[model samples]
Target chain A: MQPKSVAVVGAAETTRLGKIPDVSVIGLHADAALNAMKDAGLKPSDIDGVATAGISPVELAHYLGITPTYADGTSVGGCSFMLHVRHAAAAINAGLCKTVLITHGESGRSRVGAGGFGRAPSSLMGQFEMPYGVTSPPTMFTIPVLRYMKTHGVTEEDLATVAVIQREWAARNPRASFKDPITVDDVLNSPMIAWPFRMLMCCLVTDGGGALILTSAERAKDFPQKPVYILGTGESVETPMVSQMEDFNSSKAFRVSGKKAFDEAGIQHADVDHLMIYDAFAHLPLYGLEDLGFVKPGEAKDFIRERNTAIGGKLPMNTNGGGLSYMHSGMYGMYALQESVRQMRGTAAAQVEGAKISVSHGVGGMFAASGTVIFTNEK
Target chain B: MARLLPEPTPETRHFWEGCRDGELRLQRCTDCTHSYFPPRAFCPKCGSRDVEIYAASGKATLYSYVINHRPRPDMGTEPHSIAVVELAEGPRMMTNIVGCPQTPEALILDMPVQVRFDKQTDDISLPLFEPAKG
Candidate 1:
């Protein structure tokens, strides 16, 4: 269904973005949720719908003392929040609920109240993948990247440039974890985590959370904040195992979800004033750019090398520093959504001037799943 | 300490058992003739319950790989190659490329390889791949 009149009324990250050892996982969720409610000037009783991932919606409801008429616990990993926003809009339009609150919180650094994730020894990954020492994301995610480099003729300097340019954006954001500029040599010289991926290329492990409040555009004006109208949203999933992706060079899920969103929004790549592609790793933006049709396949390396995605470029991307240099609390999608809202609201720390349209895209697992959301301040 | 090993379930007992007996076993759909790995009860391709087990040719090609350098407590400090090999029977499985150095120069993409089993536990023998010698 097309999102006709749904708008984000409230959006805020946790009071403290990085390294909050004092708050547990649920506390981070509650903090972000409460802040969003206050931002929208709403109480727990004012919310009738709730959607979340990582932490269950049931637990969030109990923690916030909310009794929602509708609840969604769609946990597809990092991109789950973008999917939540899409689902929330559909639910509001269906008259299932009036106001929906979506939240995300992960104590990735502290692992406080964080759930353990691993396949059983008898599961598909255990039998087919894990026995080969493919245990963590750093290892599993590298499964496709090497082949992508080979097929695209992407050089190591091109990959390192992703980290370098993002660091340039990060240097402007005061809240960014790594504000110091890093050179391409710095990234390539950083200790290698997995082959072709150095520590600099990976996302930062921090404790943080974010929340959003959505309602029909008719009621959106009642809130204090400017409404960021939802133009389109799409979500899709591929194989759970990274190795089983349809092709190593591209993501089928990314293509499907992005096309659906762009089609629903009736917008072209040129219309996007600001963009946020969940940069959990440096290579993710390259995949997002190509798969979302913003750039041609095998050309993202050149796009970044030319600084098209950097500050003062044609397209401003990941203005909040992204997961690579910002804050990656396990699931980085919520943070991506928060940045898109900030850009649309024109209140971002590293605000893109007069940004009218913004797109937030995310990936879950390796290339296992994807969600794309398009927002416009005009409406 | 060593890396994690797979524990066979009732549905996958045959595949592991075959490895113990020096054979690479795979499941094939009786209806669609589609062969698959990691032994599932139903055929993933045709969604048919009519499936049978058969020994594979033990030949494959290196599809992709990464030389991991992180030192896990269970995996020790030495670097190892985590690879995916596309089997001659038309399925890819994640395994390690052994009998060669774990370096980018040594592990060429699309190089032909053959499976070799290493006994992890008494009841389990993990399948690993080695560079195919002509």
Candidate 2:
């Protein structure tokens, strides 16, 4: 599909983030979906197509009472919503669906009617990595950072610095789960979950979700909210196991997906007015910067340390505090995408002044999958 | 229940069986000559069905790892390294670094190591590694 052929007419997150122990997983999806629908000035009858990662599109349609010609249930990882937008744009261009609703909801903390992170013993991860005592995101997702740090001459202080910088952005946003500024020493002093990664370096375990509404650019003017044009989008997958990543220093999937989106958008890295690389772990943005060509390999740590990507830097990144200080609902891609949309619409809680371009990137399942979505306020 | 072992399928049964017999086996595509781990029927690179299995040198080097503070139920309270080692033959697989301190100074990246088998059950033997003998 051509860039700007489709646009995001609506975007909203669950009414209450952080801890919603009272709400079930599906209930969270519904709450976000209704809010997005209202933001778009539409109802169930106006939504002819549906997409989701939290649950099956069939189930979302059944619950939302939308009967459509197009339904997408692409679940690679947290970036599933980004892929849904990419696919929805293509589906809309092909006349498969007029308007698509992409939803993501996870009771990450509450676990109310939610599935726990358990791999079946017969599955590949259960068979290979699990038996070795590797468990949880802290154990598996963090497996590659040691080599990355060693090769780049990065100190443990560099990792903690990421959390510190993100909290600076978080302190500005009232919706952020963690608003208090933390020092690198505070981060280093936090409890250790894995070597080179303290508790502060890890993402928050909160219960929340968000949704998006997409339609043709022609119909975008009808929406109540400003349109966030889908300028470029890309998605790809690599090995499911973190151990099998092509390189210990960079994510091959992130490189592939980020390049595809940048190429499709026909924009250089310098054109990105704002950015969001999924910070599930503090080290991820380091990998993202290098792999996404925003910085050279082994230089992202210093780039971050020099405050290049921090608040008031040349590249205003993760202004919503990211998954580190912001609310992380297991799948963090949705929140990252929401922040990008907010930046483009000039409504972010910690808004970047006059921001026009934003790139949102995400990784799923210990670097197993990645997706990138480039949005622009201008058509 | 926490000693999560892989229930080998037909595609990967030989790998588990080789471990049971004190062998570290790897599959290589005869077409592309690319060696890979966690054995499969076809080459991941060239997607060729023509492949062969061979006993690796049982030699490897530490590629990457994380010293997991949270140990598995079967493992004692002490931290252990969940590591990926690059085989001398050119494939990487997940394993534990045994017979060495699971500390940053000791578990250095690129350190030479040799594979050893720990027979877990009648049907399973885990491939573990220790510092290579000089």
Candidate 3:
């Protein structure tokens, strides 16, 4: 049986990207949620469900004056929203709830107040990973990236295509952190932040918020906005600890998640008109392109170097500038969904012509959890 | 300068005791004799509670490694070699390779290595590994 259609009715975000000292994290979330509702012509009472990541769901619901019938506070890292997208869709399909609001906000770059949302203490994950002094998200990702380069002979310049190409897109995106163009030489010359990696290769940390509203297809038509359909989604866990993974060079999580999502959607890589592979680091997209079947393993570098991922390339990726240029916002996955929705609605400033199909893949917990969602204008 | 940093929990106590007593310990299934690391009480091979801890020859080869140059709070200024070693006893162990420079030229893949100890404090002597002396 085919899946029921879950349409994204509204999407909106805060004005600032890197650092917004004027607004609190909750304030940012509330603003984005209200804007999304306004854009979708939804009232607070219209939202019967709420899902949040890296922030408190109950708190966000409270601020929005929404006593949601359903709420989720899943913390699987950046990809939590991608997982939430699938969960929210299933819930609406099952008639569990309608008009779900998914939101994310963070003051990561500003390091606002040194605390906002804290996970459960009993989690051994922080202990195993943090004490090794692997505090930053990109640091953990670099481990596998380094191993990938070592095994594949992929160079730093090869991985630089992710940042360089995304930066080019950011040049056109007014909200991007970096408006200036950067070249492979600039990436190679950048200071070494991590061995086998340079400063240009890592993603930026910034403060921002993004919110999207999902409703049943039947209800979406009743709303005032165009419906961007959720084509297919898949979520899974490969390994919680970076060390436990058998293959550091390749993300088994991405391989498994992408295969399942593509198969469920009944779509091949060629069918995707655009892509939003998460760029927590430049290597992410490089490896993601390889794992998502866009290119052969160990060939992402050459593909990217050949400019296959540029603005005018075969796949116009991260059209809203991605984490490198757009807003990291703690978890960048939510923005992936936002961008896909915008593109399908033909509302994106950098909208790709005839963009009917797009893929947004999110990874969290040092390649531990992965979720992939395919969005299409056609149901 | 070598001492027991922190012994393994009940889940890995035998592995710790083996290192302390000069033996490379592995969790083995009494039924299949398969060994594993980051030890577990139950045998993964047969899903059996019938398992025993045995001493290995403390030998392994470099399965993979990365020289981490990023500044870390706990590790301080020195670059460290993070290696995943494929043990002769069958399981892979995540450990640091020390007593030599951390570089691709210095650390080669498939190079024979043996376990060593770095005494961090009274209760925590880390089990570090290094190249086996010729």
Candidate 4:
């Protein structure tokens, strides 16, 4: 269903980003939820719908004293928040709920009240992938990158350029965890976590949370802040294990979700003034740009190396420093959405000047799932 | 410290049993003629239940890989290559590359390889890969 009338009326990150050892996983959710409620000039009693990932919606609603008419807990992975936005829009358009709040919280760095995730030995991954020593995301995610590099003729230097460009974007934002400029040499020289992935190429681990409130476009104007209209949204999932991805060179989910969003938005690629591709690792943005049709396959590395996605570039992407240099609290989709809203509202820390349209895309579980959202301030 | 071990279930018992007996077994679909790894009840390609387990040719080609430097409690401090190999019968499986240096220079993509079992426990034997010998 086309949710033409749904819009983001409220958006806010937790008061403090980066490191917060004091806040539990649920506490981070409440902090961001409370901040977003204040941003929308709404109270807990005003919310009738709740959606969240990482943490359950039931816990969020009960903690915030909200009894919702509808609730959605679509936890695919980091991109779960993007899926939540899509689901919330559909729910609102269907008259399932009037006001909806979507939240995300992760204690990735602190590990306080954080949930433990692992595959059972009896599970498919445990029996197949894990037995050979594929344990964490850093290792599992690299399974495809080597193939991608070999097929595309992408060198280690080209991969380093991905980190360098994002770090350039990160240097402009104060809230970014690592603002210091890093060179391609620095990225290559950084300690190796997995082959083809160095320390600088990976995302930062921090503790933070973000939330958004959505309502019908008719009532969005009544809110204090400008409403970022949800022009289009799409989400899709592939396999549970990263090893089972249909193609090693590309993410099928990213292609499906992004194409659907672009088709629904009815906008050309040039119309996107801002873009956010979840940068959990350097290779992701490369895959995202190609899979989303912004650049041709085996060409994103050159697109980035030429400064096409950098600060002065035609397409300002990951302007919030991205998860690479910014605060990645495990589930980074919410932060990407927050930056898109901020760019549309003309209030971002590293604002892309005169930005009207923004496309926020996210990946969950090492390209296992994807969600794409197209937002615009033209109401 | 020893790394995590696989605990075979009723469905995967045959696969483990084959490995312990020095054979690489996989499932083949009667309807679609599709061969696959990781024991399952139905054929993943055609969704056919007419699947049977048989000893594979034990030949594969290196598809992709990474040399992990980070030391796990069980994996020791030295770097090792975690690789995916496409079997001759037409399915890829994750395994460690043995009988070769775990470096990008040595682990060539699409190179011919064969499976070798390393018995992790009395009942479990993990399948690994090595350069194919003439």
lDDT of 3 by residue, B1-134 (tens): 12113334557556555555566677788888778655677886688899987777778877765566774655777777666677877677667777788887888777889888555554344566789989
TM-score of chain B taken alone, every candidate: 0.96, 0.95, 0.87, 0.96
DockQ, in order, for the candidates?
A: 0.73, 0.80, 0.33, 0.75
Tell me which residue pairs clash in candidate 4.
none
Candidate 4 residue-wise lDDT, A115-212, digit = tens: 77688978888788876666678898778998999899999898888888888888888889999998889999999998978988888999999999
lDDT of 1 by residue, A90-127 (tens): 99999999999999999999888887868897787877
Clashing pairs for predicted structure model 1, backbone only: none
Q: Number of the top candidate by DockQ?
A: 2
**lDDT minimum window of 10 residues, candidate 4 chain A:** A128-137
Query: Considering TM-score, which of the candidate structures 2 and 3 is the better prediction for this target?
Result: 2
lDDT score, candidate 2, position A175: 94
RMSD of 1: 1.3
The true-versus-predicted C-alpha distance at residue A232 of model 2, in Å, is 0.7
**lDDT of candidate 3 over A1-379, digit per residue (tens):** 1343888888888656678887777877877888888889988998999999767888888888998888989888889998888889988887789889998887777766337532232233332233234435545567666567778988777777778888988888887888899988998888876566778877788888889999888778887888888888888887766767768767888988898889888887889998998987888887788888899988888887787778788988888888878878778888888888888888887889998898999988778888998988876
Model 4: TM-score for chain B: 0.96
The candidate maximizing lDDT is 2
The alpha-carbon lDDT assigned to residue A244 of candidate 3 equals: 70
The sequence of per-residue lDDT tens digits that candidate 2 reaches over residues A97-211 is 8999999899999998897778887778878888898878898899888888889888889999999999999999999999998999999999878887789999999999899
With a 3 Å backbone cut-off (N, CA, C), the pairs that clash in candidate 2 are none
Runs in model 2 with CA error above 4 Å? none
Q: Candidate 2 at residue A302, lDDT?
A: 90
True contacts kept of 2: 0.83
Worst 10 residues of 2 chain A by lDDT: A115-124
